[model samples]
Target: MPAVAPTLPDDLREDPRYYLRHFQFVLDWVAAHHDSLLAESEWKFIVGFGELPEVSQALLVRMVSRKGELFRLSRLDYAEIGDSDRALVPLVEAGMVIRDPLIGLDELFAQLRVPELRQCFAERLAAHGIAKSATRQRLLDVIQEYEEAGDAEPQRRRLSHWWTETTDQLVQLTVMPVCDRLRLMFFGNLHQTWSDFVLAELGLVRYQQVDLGELSHAFQCRGDVDLYLALHDLRGRLDEGESIEALLTEIPPPAQDNPWLAERRARLLYRLGQQAQRDGDIPLALHCYGLAGPGEARIRRLRLLERQGEYAEAHRLALEAQASPCGEAEQQGLERLLPRLARKLELPRPELPPTRQPRARVLELPADHLVICGSVELAVRDAISHSDRPAWYVENGLITGLFGLLCWEVVFAPLPGAFFHPFQHGPADLRRDDFVARRRRLFDTALARLDDGSYRDVILDHRQRCAGLANPFVHWELLEPELLSLALDCIPAMDLRCMFQRLLLDPAVNRSGLPDLVQFLPGERPSYRLIEVKAPGDRLQDNQRRWLDWLGRHHISVEVWHVEWRHD
Candidate 1:
């Protein structure tokens, strides 16, 4: 008798409709990218990798990382992604990190007793010309001891020595008002906390001994534009009820006839409109949203109209927002998002409580953390200012978000698009060399458009305009070119709720086989991929048996992954 085919693999066992060898596909994906990856470019590189097909994304992680690491990705990591849904639990449980799960900087130092980690700091300091002082060693020891046992002695010693040290006690300030260009320059990308002391004394900003969060918040509350993470506190205050209008009032708009500046003015008008909307002023909210986008503005007005049971206009604009674009994925996403919104309009809305904002709280921030944020902001800014290529800033938060932007900017200089100048295109265009430099070029352009009174897509495009959220993975930069978000032709309007269909796949393909747990992908196809997302612990839902079941039914394949298992 002819030799029977070897029993299909366990995962492929009981295959009814389809068959695909995922293991082999993963092997080829990783070998291609891992060896070529550069450390400095790691972040962008990682995000770019996501552009691969789903099977390829899943397969690449498994092939590039050890089996054990791949297993952990299935279970423990990528638990708190803010947007995209699919959970990566199984992979994490299979492979775990040896190190303690990530905690804050202080908690990390206070918890782990890895002598190797201490040695690493010692070695890094020596290499970077940061001498290992006896005081430094003492501090390290105290912190390390506290890690093993939360003895107050360690913290007390840390505090006493920190206060006595004169190392980070000086600061200096130089300001350049961004009249025409909104150019915010930090004298240096990296400043020690000591430098801040001098600035504080010079009255540039108030200094506080409290955590950086409070100090930053206080700065924002004070109405000073600080491009550092510390400004978050100020943001919170502003979010609550702080006012910075007085400070802004001092700097009058330039008399020059620049369209960009006009756009900026329009943005303020839109903001006021939002305030009115929150105040339950339906007509006013519609006006602001309209300034945001005529169609967009009308749509918002329609929401209010719909809420008041004005179905006629509400129904009309819902169709308008979903209007088809020649070839724009964003428009399509909006179009797809439209029906859900329309359905919502048909439903009754409840009376929402009045928005209550607080005054910006005042707090003293430690000098060290401020220095970190300043360094990152300055580096990226300087890089863009210095580069000949069209450069721009890409950031998430307005002021407090400067730190991360700075880090990425230092590595990626000259921001893209030579200064958000009267450009005709979006920042996703990476053909230019200064692609990374404009880490925030997207937002800057939006601001420019708003200032110019031509901000058509501002409200709907906030996510892309913000550019903050998209920078999480290294590979996303590379992935941008292939994203369905930008191209309408590449995506299909499928509710992400029931199933995730690959745009590349045609649903009408012949369905010949019976249903079994294992779905067959075209065996000859090389579409395997992997996605390694780093997120908080809650990213994966504990009740995911249903999703897994749904996923198990789909013919196209994927592996949602957690990154913890790889690096550690």
Candidate 2:
């Protein structure tokens, strides 16, 4: 039998097709005005989703409606089957959901195992006339009963699928209408329209506030819950009515020494530090940073030091942090700050020889070189990789990979006061002279590491370390050890290392816009050339120019190849 759609309320049951008609109308509007209807990524997502089977598509709709990525299978209320595992198999196969091994009952209750939550649960049970010694058993029995009741509600779904379905163009175009309808229902402003009525009927958009109530304990322990509540309370108090001292009183110390608790405490302190700094309480800001995580806390403290006109101290801290940044954003901030502090303190800048023109002439490509995929660089990479010669599309991949391998110790070293602060804007006060001097140590260290064979193991070891990080500088998979070893073998160690250093040290300017491809000649003294490829109407970016200038000054063999399209 065909699965029955759930019976709708009186308002929508009058005409069942009303919802479908409204959905179609919304899609028509989107099709007519797609440019204004959705962002590029959103449009792409919609188009990709439409190509899936209706069952898979519906699952995604239901998943998004719940406003969470992870869902419990036991709670799922599927119209098609009692067990959703088989239905979800296609979604997993499609790479829309990651099907982890089933979660057991014990892991679900781990949060309640915390002393605070256990006590809270036990106390609640005891209030119901259960004996104090028997509170634990009574609470567990109540939880088991609650679990049985909850199991019938609806199964949940996981959200970690990385959208692998969008790769097909045809599928994406087909899915556009479904995405359009979903977007209209979830996010659009509703009026006295059939669409609005049907949307409410289907429960796609929720106006009601969602809270787990007692079930929240299943996720976070009482201590974390309290901290979360306090953080929100602090935000409101700081914005509205409370004095700094009063606000500080609500911020609690970490109740547990776990990483999660430490992170929570650090975040609270960081926020308090920001508020204190804005309020012109430098000492308080410094104190909060003192207790906060090494990532943003250290950077904020450095800023406070600079603001206090302690140029000497700021410069010292900035130099120390510059060698191993918490992240690219932090490094950029420090690079910008270093020069100003140095100028203020009358520090001598690093000396460099005048920029020199390339000793090897720019290699020009044939006037009829075919452009591929709107990228001359990619075309060059393709040609070089496919050729018999020992070549790869190394680009930034090679140097960074080598650096990660050789300078692992220096790269991952804890920069004193280095902490990651997300969503921080790049520094507004950047000076070229300050960076030229501050980056010397980074460059020199990289050079020294290249001279020693020990650093190769460091890079290999760093592979495991970097996997857990958000953005890794080197992609080890792309540049395999054998290929990288070959490149290093051919190129002079210091020269290769310095080129990589130039890219790593001044990453803000010189990291990207590297030459398109690198090819090594097979000989006694293996020679490698850096090639920049450009198609018609393509020009070098400022950063690329800076890289080329640096490469030339260091006497590295580099060339620019202008590729012209061939009409067959």
lDDT of each: 0.31, 0.54
TM-score of 2: 0.36
**Candidate 1 local lDDT, 1-568, one digit each (tens):** 1122112243433332111232222122222222232233332333444444443334333323222121222232321231111322222222211111323335333422345334535544454454444354554655465445755443422211323322211111111111100111111111222233234334444311211111111111111222222222333443565434422233234224332333334444455555667767666567555555433344445556666776656666656655542122223234434565556656533232222221111222333433453543233223333222221222211111221222232222333222211111122223222333344454344334434533324322432443523232122232232222221121111212123121111111111111111111123331221111212242433113223333345422323332221221
Off by over 4 Å in 1: 1-271, 294-301, 324-416, 419-556, 559-568
* Model 1 per-residue lDDT at 368: 46
Question: lDDT score of model 1?
Answer: 0.31
Estimate, for each residue in 1-568, the C-alpha lDDT of model 2 and write its tens digit: 1132123334545552344433433433343333343446555554555566655655555554443345555444566433455556666766666554333333333323344334545545555565556544555677566556779743322111111221211011123333434343322211123444455555543222122122111112335444544565576677775666677776777766334445556777788788888888888888887677566787888888988888888788778887787654465466567767777888776333345544433334443444333456666666565333566776767776666556543443323211111111111111122332444576466567567855565566655554323223456557676676667567787686667767555554455777778887757867788888766667776557667778888788888876665455
After superposition, the stretches of candidate 2 with alpha carbons farther than 4 Å from their true spots are 1-374, 381-388, 414-447, 456-471
Error of 1 at 435 (Å): 10
